[model samples]
Target chain A: MDWVSHAQAELRGAGYRPGAAARLVLEHLDREDCCRGAQEIFDALSTGGTKVGLASVYRMLERLDERGLVQRIDLGDGIVRYEAARDAGHHHHLVCGACGKVEPFADRRLERAIEAVEERSGYSVVAHDVVLRGACANCRD
Target chain B: MDWVSHAQAELRGAGYRPGAAARLVLEHLDREDCCRGAQEIFDALSTGGTKVGLASVYRMLERLDERGLVQRIDLGDGIVRYEAARDAGHHHHLVCGACGKVEPFADRRLERAIEAVEERSGYSVVAHDVVLRGACANCRD
Candidate 1:
């Protein structure tokens, strides 16, 4: 919970204060190596005896996302998943529709293609999300 | 409403019976050129004096998505936007983070890359969604 003081500093630099709930969320994200949704984070906090509302978890996550402390991923299932952006860098996901398994992927060639797209589209691409949905190997088996 | 019989036929062929509520959702999608969420469709139905619950709209949309009768797009803001897939072959979007404006886009190179990713990952790649978010031209102005 203390190593995330940097994340709180980032929020503070952006003119926002990160409180206990924010710390719990960041602590959860820091420990978690995979992407998680707000509900999952809220449930984890509640199970740990932390008193926080689901709405507050959502609000903190949204603010963290806006500050780039967390990366929001859309798995195309009406749910936005979040992972800590710090040290996670930029990446995409191969999400299994059947199992809800998310496999993070990165490719230099795809990055170049996305840059070319930004040039052709005339829109400054600040952030992009690529989600490939299909049956995983186990699911297909 | 009757013109969407073909859509219902597609659903039926896929072993799904398009109920009255499903028909209303399909009719709404048929007329909408842009993507919409379940609540929007539900509100629209209510405004037009069509009685359909929000949960029913959500259920129908999920069923339609499972049957490949509709395409769901996630704009990364925790909202899953749906568009009728009968005539909407395949496309991506440049979503305005500021105004929620979705601009559809298509790219041959990106499509090829997706195909390549499918080959490499061994996933069937049933469907893929690419969303680029940034400030729109109007927002920048």
Candidate 2:
């Protein structure tokens, strides 16, 4: 996991100021290894001294997405969510609508089908996000 | 194709007034096949002197959706789109983003995967809609 220093460097490369807010988001969400919304990130970063607004969180996250440091997911909600792009492996998500629990999984077959569509359609497929949403284990019981 | 009278009967059965505006929208979108959005349906009825407000179009369409007379699709666009649901079997769409054209296809492999997930998780999968968007051949050329 990229710690605070490395995350700050990433922000600097992405042309954002190496501020405390940006570093806090990168490190915390990168460590979580799952998708999260901006409000959740703000909660994680809130401290007595550190000041971060939800709007700033959204702006910083959008900047990270532009820099390829993170990916934004729509998740059928009006608000967009983010997951870190560290290690750069392809994967998809399983979301629990009941509890909002998210599980990330790597599915090769689905990826191949997407690639096939790209090749056949002549659309240079930049990125694809596959999501499967349903009730999770505990939610069923 | 369900004409105005039958649609009026269906609506009346559900206690909806068979108002001219509602009937206009119903007739405009009630193709033997294909779905139609509120804007398209409104424009189609406008030429015929139907005094349908766009808000009424939206509300009537939402009511149709609730009554199983129509289906709404995301299309990845936040704008809610309505489609007539007569003979509306389960299917998915291949949308050409560049041309705004849509084609429908059915793949049992996809259905099986949904079934597999439902069976494995014991979650009663009600329904699903898959949309694949890309630039079409003309758009590429």
Chain B TM-score of all predictions, in order? Answer: 0.89, 0.79
What lDDT, from 0 to 1, does candidate 2 have?
0.67
Instruction: Write model 1 residue lDDT over A1-141, tens digit each, in one string.
Output: 443787888888988877888888888888997889899989888999988889988998889888777888877666678998865367889988888788988776777888899888777678888888898888876
Q: What docking tier does model 2 reach?
A: acceptable
TM-score of every model versus the real structure = 0.83, 0.69
Docking class of 1: medium
TM-score of 1: 0.83
A1-141 per-residue lDDT for model 2 (tens digits): 344566568777766686666666666776776788888888877853567887888887878776667766666655568887765555666677788776766655555655565565445334555566667778865
Worst 10 residues of 1 chain B by lDDT: B1-10
Error of 2 at A66 (Å): 3.3
* lDDT of each residue in B1-141, candidate 2, tens digit only: 345566678889988777877867776776535666677777777776777898889988878766667766656555557677655466666677677776665565555664555565444333344566666667755
DockQ of each: 0.62, 0.27
Top model number, lDDT: 1
